[model samples]
Target: MSNEVKSIGIIGLGSMGMGAAKSCINAGLDVYGIDLNEAALATLSDAGAKAVSTNALDFSQQLDAVLVLVVNAKQVNTVLFKTGLAASLKPKTVVMVSATISADDAKQIEQQLNSYDLIMLDAPVSGGAAKAATGDMTIMASGSAEAFSKLKPVLDATAAKVYNIGEQIGLGATVKIIHQLLAGVHIAVGAEAMALAARANIPLDLMYDVVTNAAGNSWMFENRMKHVVDGDYSPKSMVDIFVKDLNLVADTAKDLQFPLQLSSTALNMFISASNAGHGQEDDSAVIKVFDGITLPGVEK
Candidate 1:
């Protein structure tokens, strides 16, 4: 087997997947893209992918590596198995599962892939769409040595940082889930603080400036709270995305019999936002859950 991944197929050409596909193409790899969205496929085709299709099985056997960047484990399973992409692939092909799925789901997928004599990398990514577009995303990955070796080129093209969590199938997912706990909580708490400032009649822009420069600043606070200040609830990352992610955190904790007080609170905040019809809005819109505050750009 070659040490480099020369040709690759990407399943799910959403923002993140499209960015990775474009990065791979820019890196001079033979890239094939699969997505249900015609616009997404068209965009990748224009970006010089070797092929673009709605079905993963279209060119699954032709690829050296496959990156699954779908939304969840269910969608990942649907793309790989329901569409027969896994069975259609040539043996020894590296399948990098990059969804933020539960560790158990990652382990199950790994076992199934091993049954097909394919390599599986439990890889989950962060840094969102902007970073992905620049090929500067962070990847948390775990798999066998052979899998790592085969996937190195693709990783180099797609990520600024790739942490090898372990050789265990589920280790990467575990780490990503923990990371999501921090991300979700930070966004939720940041929204709460901003809402408090608004209720106190503090100018949101000034408050934002103070918080971002102060000791209490966090990456999530600085990033997500800016959306709150601008009142731009456009979905960079939707409230429902965090709802699903924090729910994953809750489910994982339940299985481990662990307590997650702050995460649990954050989960409720997201759920409340989702319940109030902000599910599709930017996650920073969680601040909308607090009433009696006049948000910027929002009419009373």
Candidate 2:
């Protein structure tokens, strides 16, 4: 690998995927974006990206690196394996996997990619959509040296912090899973706090201000509280995302014989929120679990 990534391919154009594709374009790298959604494809094109309809349809085998930001294992396989993209990709063209996948799934995909002689980088991410759009996301990466070399431009363009966790493909996913545990717990706790404050007839604005400034604050607390305060359920990160992530955390812990009581509890809360038809809503709407409690300054 030359360590000089110029032309890149981005698969998926959802919120995070679009942000990442824009970040690459902002870094002066040529980006070929692929998505099934016509609106997302047009958005990428409008933003100066070369929008390709799909991974299988994109005629850019000259790509130095490919970034997979699709939903999960199934989508990853659909793009790389089903579309014959893995075989069609030029040798040493690094494949950066940014999806939130299980360790087993990561390992499986790594091996599958290796079969085509393509380098696989298990590079899951943090810092959400805003950070991604600003080219300031945190990447938890673990892969071969060659893979990293080919992915230099991607890391440069999309991540403010890239922790090269190890050489194993699944290590990054493991770390991301751990981080998701804390994130899910904090969001659940934040919802619980707002619910309690509302139930006690405490002024939610005052309570939110106090808790956010005090040691009780968290990133999720500050971010999600604003949604609760605004009664804006627009999904920055949807409730089902936590339902998927936290479930992964719980399953991983169980397999490792590690007891994570807090994560388990939070995972259940997310499940309940999802079951209550908040699955597609912003995760902050987990606060809706509290019956008959209205936020003072926000509409229901």
Write the residue-wise lDDT of candidate 2 on 216-288 in tens digits: 9998899888888777888888999999999899879977889999999998898888898889998987777
RMSD in order of candidates: 1.2, 2.0
Report how far residue 192 has shifted in candidate 1, in Å.
1.1
Per-model TM-score, in order, reads 0.97, 0.93
Candidate 1 local distance difference test against the native:
0.92
* Regions more than 4 Å wrong, model 1: none
Q: TM-score for candidate 1, please give it.
A: 0.97
Backbone clashes in model 1, listed as residue pairs? none
After superposition, which runs of candidate 2 have C-alpha atoms over 4 Å from their true positions? 55-57, 296-300
Give the per-residue lDDT of model 1 (tens digit) for 36-131: 999999999999999999987778878998999999999999999988889999999999999999989998999899999999999999998998
